[model samples]
Target: MQRRTWVPIATGIVALVFFALPSEEPLRGFLPDWVSLVLIYWTFALPARMMVGMAWSVGLVVDIVSFGLPGAYALSKAVLVYLARVLALRVRTYPLWQQTIVVLGLLGIEALILTLIDFIVSGDLSGLQRWTAVVVGALVWPVVYWILRRARHLARLGH
Candidate 1:
């Protein structure tokens, strides 16, 4: 692994776990996309280092843990990172509310790609769960990004 703060690595791992947890509760169908959300936050915050390959690697780990067509998430995540990388500067410069909207679009695109891949693999579209994740993630981007931002900055200040 490349040299970087453990904060993000830990956050990413936690997000993956959040993704895997059973969402059987009411409205849980719209479990926020913790992994992608964190990835987007890190990508925008540290655009110089969070490259497409990093996204690919994270997706591969996810695929290995999650049961599905391998490379499906890898591709979707890489696409998300690629888009984020392209828009990192302008996106980061925006207000948090505006940035959330941009991230929502990216998350929706990633969801669409993943849903399409799922349909292609299983011949049926996932109902609600996929899109719901996008909506939920987008809705929470600001709070998660804000918390992570503060956490990252605080750690730096402590050191």
Candidate 2:
């Protein structure tokens, strides 16, 4: 496969690995939403290559890996892709710091969708603490964006 094909796959796998790693109760919430961050970065950086269907598939993998509600993550990720696609052009122009705000909003929406699904399926809202990851993800957006952007340049994935 070409670099375009394998690079995203490799990055996605890394995100999933980070997402799947075990953590202590106190530290778990601090782990950024690596999967969502990657999806957003790719969506912004390569709008034509990253589609809603692809996001859904990645979310499904996340769902399976996390052992959550079957379609919860999938549905949320699909929605995230749709929203990201709609805002891709605009978001891409912003400086990385400003883009961090947008990323926070996007990740928050994903969290909302997951929270709603959890409520509907299990009647438990869990805790507000779960949102810590959203904040962490926003703060980590620059790093994620920089890393992926560097990778893209390294691979010579020209727009």
Candidate 3:
């Protein structure tokens, strides 16, 4: 059980590192939501082990690390994980490209959730430009999927 979880937790830490990295304003929107991508990957890869409470905990870490409103990201990430779990069996069999579309939709929903929270919490309405991260996340989903899959294989977690 411990070995089974090690790779996913390691990947989650890597995602959190990227999430916490500082970026200039112009490039901020372009940064892929690494945390969501990782969460989505593991949710698909290890559906039995990657549950909602774990996602909520990671989101709280993201919230603290990014200094965002508390629980904002927690709620969004929890929802993302739930949706991923619901679609996991179907999406897992999808070719990478088709899976990318699903990733885009999932991340888009997350973006909408965050947008709503931001507007309600700070009265800030985000522009469509914010959606760029969603697109980028989807575009890179195959890459993230490949890398994490490779890691899982190397870790002998089984397919």
Candidate 4:
């Protein structure tokens, strides 16, 4: 099979693992948004294969598996894909530090959107803990990118 095929399979595996991980207080509220990161990463890495529709589908799957509010995560992920597309090329050129900053900002937006949804549905404000995931996600972006980038290269997906 072509490497391009492996990319999405790898992403799906990662996302499932991400959702499967048990949340444990400080960490519970702040574990890096793993699926979100994978969604964002692959969306930008292979826009042709990963786009808004795919993000929505994956988000819905995550919501179903995680028992989150339906459409909340799906919508937020679609929005993130739009934002990532807007900055996709720019993200590729930036240094790892800069890229991490951008990922943090995107994750922040995702958290903010989810928080708004939580307020609408449950009237609970996530407070500062909602941002913990953004910070953690940003810190891990380079590692995720490195591994995925190598996979992309091996798959002959384009530079």
By TM-score, who's the top model here? Answer: 2
Q: Each candidate: RMSD to true structure?
A: 3.1, 1.6, 1.8, 1.9
- Residue pairs with clashing backbones, model 1: none
lDDT of 1 by residue, 1-159 (tens): 234488788889999998888866786778877889899888888888788999999998888888867899899999999999898989877998899899889999998898889788889875677787787788998789888888678556221
Please state the error at residue 67 of candidate 4 in Å: 0.8
| Candidate 4 C-alpha lDDT tens digits along 47-138 | 66566887788779878888888899899998999899888877888888888889999999998899999999999785777787689889
TM-score of each: 0.90, 0.95, 0.93, 0.90
Cα lDDT over the full model 4: 0.81
**Model 1: residues with Cα > 4 Å off, grouped in runs:** 1-4, 157-159
Off by over 4 Å in 3: 1-4
Q: Quote the lDDT for 29 in model 1.
A: 73
lDDT of 3 by residue, 25-113 (tens): 89987888899999998889878878899899999999999888889999999999999999999998898889999999999999999
Candidate 2 off by > 4 Å = 1-3
Q: Write the per-residue lDDT of candidate 2 for residues 26-112, one digit (tens) a residue.
A: 897788879999999888888888889999999999999998888999999999999998999998889888899999999999889
* Candidate 4 TM-score to native: 0.90
